[model samples]
Target: MQESATIIDIRHIQVGYGQKTVIGDVTLTAGPGELIGILGPNGSGKSTLLKSLCGLLPYSKGEVLLFGRPLLSMSERDRARQVAYMQQEVQVSFGITALDAVLTGRYPYLHWWQNESPADYAIARQYMSFAGVGDLAQRPLHELSGGERQRVMLAKALAQETPLLFLDEPTASLDLSYQEEIFRYCQQICREGKTVLIVVHDIRLAAKFCSRLILLSAGGILSDGPPSQVVTPEHLYQAFGLQSAVYENYISGQLDIHTYDRRSAGQPGKAIHVIGGGGTIGTIIRALRENAYPVSCGILRQGDMDTAVAMAFGTDNLVSQAFGPIGRELGEQNRQKIAQAHYTILGNLYFSQENLDNLKAAFTAGRLIIVEDSPINSRDGTAGEAALLYRQLTARPETTVMKLDELLLAVEKRSL
Candidate 1:
């Protein structure tokens, strides 16, 4: 394939089984070095679309072009030389060594009745090692574990060395480590000018690795673009009926999703103000939202992890700038939010000079719930000033200090 050449062109294709249409009027253009992820819920035509692209499943209408040539006009061997396909599962009825399975990838390059040459074996072994399955070369394909067999099949596909690769849930059976390994390998190979289209169920993994994403829904394309464009909360809800919090994960520095069940019936009741940061208030915010409470968070810094979670859940939040102490203006805003709320929750966050105003504002709550997982003195970094204020707040007649578990139970009981 040359630079800027279109590797695969799927135009207005319709695919189905018997009389039922599973994919309808989908058009996509993939160029060299693009790693596209096919993502959607089950029965969304992810697998059927993949098979149709490579000719394993017939399309009812429209055309598929490889290198601007009609796909249906290509011979089986000719197409195999340009495209490599890995199915969802591989079952070997007859016993075959793993080495033999991988060596079969080279058949497209051989003549009829011709045996594999030494160079073909070398290529197979090279790919087996690359897939981390070199040690299992002598083992029987049927005797290998699920993950091991997946690696062997991946090796087979890699040995084909085609410019266009189609994988259907290739990492479905692998562990966490191997799942990342397979995606990383695909990324590495795509940099060398390979175009890969893979069907993936793990949204986080796809967001982290794929160059672009295609989301399907009910036999049609829902969204298609880079991960940031395709994995939005609105798209997820429309495609999968999921209510999810979509945000950038701080640790991985990638987009991540946290899905929740459908919201409970009835209007949101009882405003609750959450004053916390340093990643302590995520669960509290989620719990309140799940129970149909109007939740708001305040006095969090712009780049705080907790703030990101709050924004993803559509919480009303008042945020200050990062690395700066809360100003008097924002502090007053927080106090007003606290006054309006029916109840307030103070998460078990460490006390720092930058957030001391948050501690001061907690005094305005009519009914205060303090989560104290550890001693206050241990987490106080503001000399003795924070601990002194904390003592005064806890002594108030409306304050209730309890562990996280007890506080959650109390909230649940109150909601009931």
Candidate 2:
């Protein structure tokens, strides 16, 4: 292929079985050096699309092009030479050594009736080592663990050394380490100018490793772009009917998903204002939202984890700039929200000079629920100022102090 040329061009393709359409009007283009992830809920035709692109399944409408040529027009050997596809599951009934399985990847290069050469063995061994399955070469496929078998199969696909690689849930049954290992290998391969398209169920893993993402719905592509663009709340809801909070995890520095189900819980029109920061209130926000409570949060910094969770659940949040103290305007806004709420919750949050206003706002609530997982003095970074304020709030007539679990139970009971 020429420089920056498209390796796989799928144009308005529709694939089906026995008059029932599975993939509908899907169009996508992939060039070299790109690692794209296909993500969606089950029965969204992710596997069907992969099979159609490889010409293993017939497309009822539209066409596919490989290397600027029609996919159907290419010979099987030519197609195999250019594309390496790994299916979702491999079942071996007969006994075959792992080494022999990996050697089959060289079939495209060998002519009919041609015997395997020493160079082929070298190439197979090299990829087996690359896939971290070099030691399993002599083991029978049936005797290997699921993870071991997956690595061996991945080595076989890598040994093909094709420009375009299609993997349908290659990490399905693998352990956590093996799943990450496979994605890491794919990342390195993409850097060498090859393209990889993977059907992945783990949205967080795909967001972390894949350069681009294609989100599919029941009908067709819901969104297609970089991870930031494709893994939004709107696209996730449209594709999977999932109400989820998508945010960058502070520790992992990757996009993470927190899903909630609010359908069964009827909306209870009770306003609850939450005061929290430093990632202390994420679980509370989710629990309240899942219980169908009308929730709002305030006095959090712009980049705070609490702010992200509040925004994800469509809460009315009052936020300030990062590293800056809560100003009069935001503090007053939070107080107003707290005064309007039926109940206010103070999460188990560490107090600093910057967020001291959050504790002051809690006193404005008609009824207060204080989540005291840790002692007040332990989280008192304000030289006992916050602890003094917290003690006074808890001493109020309508205040109730409880642990996190008890607080959740109280909220749930109040919802009923």
Best by TM-score: 2
Q: Looking at candidate 2, what is the lDDT of residue 337?
A: 92
lDDT of 2 at 220: 93
Regions of candidate 1 where Cα sits further than 4 Å from its true position: 264-269, 352-354, 378-383, 412-416
Q: Using lDDT as the measure, which candidate wins? A: 1
The positional error of residue 326 in candidate 2, measured at the CA in angstroms, is 3.0
- lDDT scores of the candidates, listed in order: 0.91, 0.89
Clashes of 2: 0
Q: For each candidate, what TM-score against the reference?
A: 0.93, 0.93
* Model 1 worst lDDT run, 10 consecutive residues: 260-269
Tens-digit lDDT track of model 1 for 340-383: 99999999999989999999999999999999999999989999
